[model samples]
Target: MTFLNRQIHFTAAPKRKVLVGFILFLFLSFVIIFVEPFDTDQYHSDHKILVLSGFGILIFFVFVIYSSFENLWYLKFRKVWLVSHEIASTILFFVVAGSVLYLYNGLMINQGSYSITSHLLYLKNIVLLMIPVFAPVMLYLRQQFGERIVPLPINSVLLTGENKNEVLSLEKGNLLFIKAFENYVEIHFLDEQDQVVSRTFRQTLSNVYQQIPFLEKCHRSYLVNMTTAKEIIGNSQSAKISFIHGEKTIPLSKTYYKQIKNRLVQK
Candidate 1:
């Protein structure tokens, strides 16, 4: 249960998911042609390639559709995906894809005479055989093409102080972190010359966060721009956020440690 609850990185891009599906199609086709795991010998030699290619095509479509829907679900909910979600999806894929393959084999290969018992047995065999191949390929592809940075929706943000006139316009990427001092919040960001600079504003940290929701509240008095965060150093009890271009480190409270860690994993 603990392992399943552990947070893991997820690949949500449609293009990358399609790419993975295409690669899996080629791999399945290759396995059918050479490995002959699915009783390819029963079919006529001349039509073997065509018949086996059908299996790969079905797999490709199922993977693309399933993965795309999963991505859509995540996007709709805006929730953090965990290891349990990955495991559940994998199991669901096996059942869904296996049923499709079983139907294809029965109607096309067995002339609608394939029995349910046989389908069950073959499904078991296929699952066992695929666990080794599918797991590694998916893992490798995700690691290679996973989303590494959080994209900014806008170029710049206008942060206003208590007085409407006290406003600071900053590039989304240049902003580093915000620190609260009593009633005033200090904004730290990079300038045009790529130098660290600070500006003081009469605003509450909470108000600043509402204006720039992308900034992560790592501490009660601090909100860090996770996009600029290079890495998090330290453990669950206490952690520090290091920026990509700045020496400044933001204190990560124990309360937000897990949340910050999950965000970094997505990165």
Candidate 2:
């Protein structure tokens, strides 16, 4: 996606969710200052409203940064990456928020710098207050944007080749064709943008078919997604298959040519 498009569509959650989260955080900061439940050595009760309002503004900025990171970068990976990303982001969120609050607290008290011990205590308090508020919100976000709601194809066909250590996932309904490459296979499929992309796996075509039964064998060296097959040329003995949006012509072997023709006609 282009930078402009990515910025426009940053989060998978509806705009309502983001708006709700922003409002909740803003109100929560206001309440925390007003309640004065925690130790407030930094400011007197008179400045509580002002100090916490500053905190609220900081939270808003941090939230936007976190959302941009999610929208621009983190959306590409699967759940495995998301799990680690969430943990790291949580730490980063707290660190940035805590640092900003520390600077604000120092400036408020007319001190150029605050003691590390006092700042740590303040940070601890912030974390304690934020955990309860953010946990449920994060859970709701995961439910909205996660695999539970949107099924990604990567979860379906996880193919690993014997020659390569890396494992590749094929998204469902995007795979168009597979061409054999000796002991490996080169997969040609459509990406999220419906653009053609290729990935080479160190696995045999036969092994792939065992896992993915939907792919029909067209030639000894080629496996075609019959659903994408658009035209057939010549007879069963010697024929060629053309696919929609597929540039290369796949050989229609005599062995499977009849079956492919019949399937194409039926489909």
The numbered model that scores best in lDDT is 1
Q: List the residue pairs that clash in candidate 1.
A: none
Q: With candidate 2 superimposed using the best TM-score fit, by how many Å does residue 57's alpha carbon deviate from the native?
A: 1.9
- Candidate 2, residues 1-267, lDDT tens digits: the string is 233222111244546446645765666575567655456434566665766677667666666666666655454543223444555566676777677767776676446667888778777876656667765665565445443223344436666677647576666567788899778798888887888888887788898897677889989899888877788888887799987874757789999977888898899
TM-score of candidate 1 on Cα atoms, chains taken together? 0.53
Collision count for each candidate, in order: 0, 0
In the order shown, the candidates' Cα RMSDs to the true structure are 14.1, 13.7
Error of 2 at 150 (Å): 3.5
* Model 2: worst 10 consecutive residues (lDDT sum): 1-10
Candidate 1 lDDT over residue span 135-193, tens digit each: 77866775577654333346888788996678888899999999999999999999999
